[model samples]
Target: MANSPSSKKRARQAERRTEVNKARRSRIRTFLRKVEEAITGGDQAAAAEALKSAQPEVMRGVTKGVLHKNTASRKISRLSSRVKAMGA
Candidate 1:
């Protein structure tokens, strides 16, 4: 219960931010899932392309504060390595 007017305003702002962050997180997951599917499907080219597209989305999640920078970097690193390994 937000009794103070300022606190109420903050609560409203938080609700809006929550919706935006949720959408961003969902979009990032969708991109990641696409990369995973491509990789698992064993199409090297498609997986590489998916990873290329997912990299920026993952980084955007970091910038938007939904994901940690290190977490995003690690995910990108692992996915890239997998994509690279698929070529071998």
Candidate 2:
């Protein structure tokens, strides 16, 4: 469907970017899952640590255009709240 050379090149680039973004998203999810597992296991310290570690990764995702800033902020807020509640 890409008749123009530029369009064909763009299609190719999109395919490659899709793979990269998918991998990045998957890695972000894995980090989030670690925090979730820590929280679910009732380990406040581990959950806090995981949240700390995940914060930068999530923010980096936003900076890299892999995620929205508000979305990342919401996730961080919720996770930290859950971690805080775990201590109480």
Give the per-residue lDDT of model 1 (tens digit) for 1-88: 9999999999999999999999999999999999999999999999999999999999999999999999999999999999999989
| Worst 10 contiguous positions by lDDT, candidate 1 | 47-56
**For residues 1-88, what per-residue lDDT tens digits would candidate 2 score against the true structure?**
8999999999999999999999999999999999999999989999999999999999999998999999999999999999999978
Model 2 lowest lDDT segment of ten: 79-88
Candidates in order, TM-scores: namely 0.98, 0.97
- For all predictions, the C-alpha RMSD in Å is 0.5, 0.5
